[model samples]
Target: MLTIGTKAPLFAAESTKGRIDLQTLIGKKKLVLIFYPGDETPICTKQLCAIRDRYSDLEAADAVVIGINPADLTSHQAFSGKFGYDFPLIADEDQAIRKAYKVGKILGFLFQQRIVYVIDKQGTIVYAKKGNPPVTELLQVVNQNP
Candidate 1:
């Protein structure tokens, strides 16, 4: 697992919006990178929907939320469309980003664990936790760091 206070590993990848370059995003706003197991699963759907529903709050705090999954672009497109999510859902098809972030498979299972990394404007990781953290808590982290 990545520890707090460390520099976030930068990457460029395809998202629902287009190619996202983490380096460029670093100095722009607080970043919330959500790594989930897969798309369309019950828990995954709920987790994403919660973020989608509270997206305005995230924006209010000057935070950008990006979800990463191993699923392909087609699956990501369908999932984001179904949920009406406005944020970018990145497709980590080769799992390189997942491994770099240290969100590896869970308990020998095929899917990665649900992990969230909150990075500040300087690219320092301020919060790193497992499972679905409350939207309020994430906003608090972003506001505090700023």
Candidate 2:
């Protein structure tokens, strides 16, 4: 997992809309990177939808919440459209971004460990949640600090 104050690793990933450079998406806003296990799974769905519902709040905090998963772009698009997700879902199909972010995976499974990285404007990871953090608390931090 990335630590606070260390610069976040750069990434250019496939997104439902198009290829997105991390820096570009974050721009001048705080970047909250949510790394999920996979798409359409129960917990993932709930967490994402929760975030979806709070898009405006995140935007108000001057943060853009980007979900990163190993799923392909097609699945990501369908998932986003199905749920009307306002934020971007990043397709880390090759798991490059996952590795860069230190989102370790199970040996044989395709799923990634759930983690969230809250990065400041300068790209240092200011906060990091290594496992399945309590949703309410995470949301609170994102909502309050965004």
Candidate 3:
């Protein structure tokens, strides 16, 4: 996992909202980057759904929440539509973003490890954790860093 206070690796990838370059949002918004295993899976869905439930709070804190996985755009679209998630879901089809972040695999490479990173407005990571963390905890980190 990327450590706290490290500069986030920048990347441009196709998302549900089209192409997004992390560098562009560096000074504009704090980032909540959720790296999950797959789309519409049990735990992944629950994790993203939690974020969706509190998305307004995240927005109010001046954050841009993005979910990433190796799932393609079509899979992402269907998942997002089914869940009514307003945030962009990146289709890391080639796993380039995952590799850049050093997110490892689990269960003999069957799935990517779930990780979450909170990047402040200046593009430095403020929080990095494994598994599903509560949204309140994320909000707390964002509020503290800001």
Local distance difference test values of all predictions, in order: 0.93, 0.80, 0.94
lDDT of 1 at 30: 92
Tens-digit lDDT track of model 2 for 1-146: 87877889988877776777876755577887899988888988998888777678778778877899988888999999999988889988778899998888864766799899888777778889876555466556655543
Task: Name every residue pair that clashes in candidate 1.
Answer: none
Ranking by TM-score: 3, 1, 2
Model 3 lDDT-worst window of ten: 92-101
1 or 3, which is superior by lDDT? 3
Q: What is the lDDT of residue 20 in candidate 3?
A: 89
For model 1, the run of ten residues with the poorest summed lDDT: 102-111
Q: Which pairs clash (backbone N, Cα, C closer than 3 Å) in model 3?
A: none
lDDT of 2: 0.80
lDDT of 1 by residue, 18-105 (tens): 9999989989989999999989999999988998989999999999999999999999999999999999999999999998999978
Instruction: List candidate 2 segments past 4 Å from native.
Output: 25-27, 134-146
Top candidate by lDDT: 3
Candidate No. with top TM-score: 3
By lDDT rank, best first, the candidates go 3, 1, 2
TM-score of 3: 0.98
